[model samples]
Target: MPKKRVQVVLNEDIRKLGNNGDLVEVAPGYARNYLIPQHKAVFATPGVLKQVERRRQAEQRRLEAQRQEAIAFKDSLETIHRFRIERQVGEGEAIFGTVTNQDVAEAIQEQTGREVDRRGISLPDEINKIGFYKAHVKLHSDITAEIEIQVAPS
Candidate 1:
């Protein structure tokens, strides 16, 4: 006998299946046992599908607004020459301590009036000297921007 399949609306994003408010087909057993029990999905009846459409529309609007904000932030970063971070300098031009991702994120937030997650900042190498370095900011999945960071003695 052919495996039973059912259509449902996802309440949350699932890696391989679909995103929240998406209509998807899955095995009946999986949908009833896992998705329904976990409150991750609901049967795609006409009424529920209408609700899902509304939710999807709202989510799209929110995402679009975020993308626009991200684009403006990227433009601001591109216009900036360098972001200065002050640290104690040891003998020679070496910094007393390493500059971490959190340091970079904080500096960006201070200068740009925007908050960036430390995980979104990509460092090419360990910054252990009082000098200049480039850090890549992942603003969105499809958008990235590079910023010049200057480490100077306090």
Candidate 2:
């Protein structure tokens, strides 16, 4: 029988994950030749296993700091700017057409000077009605943003 050790980088935040971190079980050859060499992480030796505690703590602190900063930045933005869109409407108050990500990107660019990706700017599955809406901007895997959109007669 053969036994080996390996370390896994937490793709998601580690705070929620238990202290027993997810260690990618792999052949020692692959762990040494590929994963560890790539800096993906280290082999779970006694010393490295000891680091999980510190590393998790450090990651948690960093995540919290980043979250706080994002909140503060979002608050500041709320006071100064909001992303808005304009569209043509029909007599019945229904939007004549639709609003796509490009429209939202351009609106954000024009309003806030922030170049957001259309893919990153998510609209309703189908935004055909004339009204205000909210779009989620995936700032990070763990962080997201919402922007106010105003649809009016174009």
Candidate 3:
């Protein structure tokens, strides 16, 4: 006689098996004695599969909506285009302090009335002099905006 296998839906990730919400086949003994008793998985039934499918669809829809919102924000930031920062100068055009991401974020907030995370802003190089520079702001994982930065002597 051969051992029987049963189908079950994983409640969470199981090593060398499958991830949460996945339907996988395992030994009947393991499913009945261990996985089911431990609340790690449930027998794969028609109703359970349907419920899991619904949850997956809902999650996909929510993520798509969030991505769309991020796209709109990126467009708005691009429209504004430029941000200016006034820094104290020492000699020539060299500024006394370096231009940091925090400064750029504040500039955006002051100009557009929108709060941006400083950690998401990337400066190309050191902005220690009065000049025009470019900055890349990551609004989302897939969306980025380029802004012109004008550094001037205060």
Candidate 4:
């Protein structure tokens, strides 16, 4: 017999299934053995579907607001010509410590009043010297901006 399939409403995001409040189809065995017991999903009954729909609407509105904020932040980020980081200098223009992605994220937050995850910042290379460099930041999945970073001797 063909494997049985069941429809479920997701209560939380599942990497393979779908996002929270999404209606998805999966094997009955998987749904019953894991999803239902774990409370990650529920059978797609009429009532459950209605509830999921309401949650989806709320999630959509929140996501839209976040996207707008990200866009505005991107605009502001583009306007920034450079960011300077002061570090102790040694011989041959070498910095005592490296300028890391976490440092870049903190600098952006301090300068722009917006928080950025360190993982979202990409450095062209390891910053071991006092010089100007370009750093790319992913504000959102679809929005990216580049900023100039100047490492200066303190």
Candidate 5:
């Protein structure tokens, strides 16, 4: 049997739970296909795991500390004021204009000093007329924000 140094993906939070020099049991197929290709994990030897335990502990602590920092920032982000976009209403009880994704992104950047890409802003539907609307900002996979825009007569 040929022993191979293989990288494996753990079910745990690999960022905090493992170190480069630590050996973890992973599926041979997974090690050969995924982890090695993505560079997300590394191969380690059995003897090295014991030595890298300390490094793993440090990484967990650091990951926790950084998580706390991110939480703090996220809380502050909730306080970010929403930018109100006012537009003119026209015939058929609709806005006399089309509000585009670029408009939404620019509004956020103008108000929050955050340069949000328009592609990340999701509108429920096309804004073809005058009305109050909600726009979505996908800040992260789990975190999102709704922005309110008011359309009025110009």
Candidate 6:
């Protein structure tokens, strides 16, 4: 006689098997003795599959909404186009300190009333002198906004 297999939905990740919420087939003995008793997985029933499908759909909807918001924000940033940062001049248009991502984020918020995460902004090079530079701001996985930054002495 052949050994019977059981279908189960994992409550947590199992090595070499599947991740949480994944449906997998395993030996009946393993499912009944170890997985069920240890609360690591449950039998994959019709109700369980339906619940998982619903949760997946909800998550997709939420992600789509966030992407839409990022698109709108990107449009707003494009309209603004440029932001200015004022710093103390030392000599020959060179500022006392280098411009940081936090400074650029603050400048954007001050000028446009929009909040941007500092970690997402990437500067081309060090900004030590008063001049025009470009920055790339990653708003979403697929969306990036380029804003011109003007550094002027205060």
Estimated TM-score for each candidate:
0.76, 0.51, 0.83, 0.73, 0.52, 0.86
For 17-113, candidate 3 gives per-residue lDDT tens digits of 9999999999999999999999999999999999989988999899999889878888888898888999998888899879999999999999878
lDDT assessment of candidate 4: 0.89
Candidate with the greatest TM-score versus the true structure:
6
- For model 4, how does the per-residue alpha-carbon lDDT over 1-154 read when each residue is reduced to its tens digit? 8877899988889997799888899999989999999999999999988887787789889998988888888889889868888999999999997999988888888898878999989997778999999998888888888889999999
Clashing pairs in 6: none
Error of 4 at 94 (Å): 2.4
Candidate number that wins on lDDT, 5 or 6:
6
Candidate 1 at 111: error in angstroms? 1.5
lDDT tens per residue, model 1, 1-154: 9877899999999999999888999999999899999999999999998887787789889999989988988999889858899999888888987888999888988988789988988986878888899989999988888999999999
| Residue-level lDDT tens digits of model 5 in 72-121 | 43454456634556777667867656888888778777776766667877
lDDT of 2 by residue, 1-154 (tens): 6686445543232344323455556566865786567655555667665676788799899988878876764554455445667777777787866888898878766766766568877887877877778777665456667777778776
Candidate 4: deviation at residue 22, Å? 3.9
Q: Which window of ten consecutive residues has the lowest lDDT sum in model 1?
A: 49-58
**lDDT of the candidates, in the order given:** 0.89, 0.67, 0.92, 0.89, 0.65, 0.92
By TM-score rank, best first, the candidates go: 6, 3, 1, 4, 5, 2
Error of 1 at 33 (Å): 9.4
TM-score of 1: 0.76
Q: How far in Å is the alpha carbon of 139 misplaced in model 6? A: 1.0
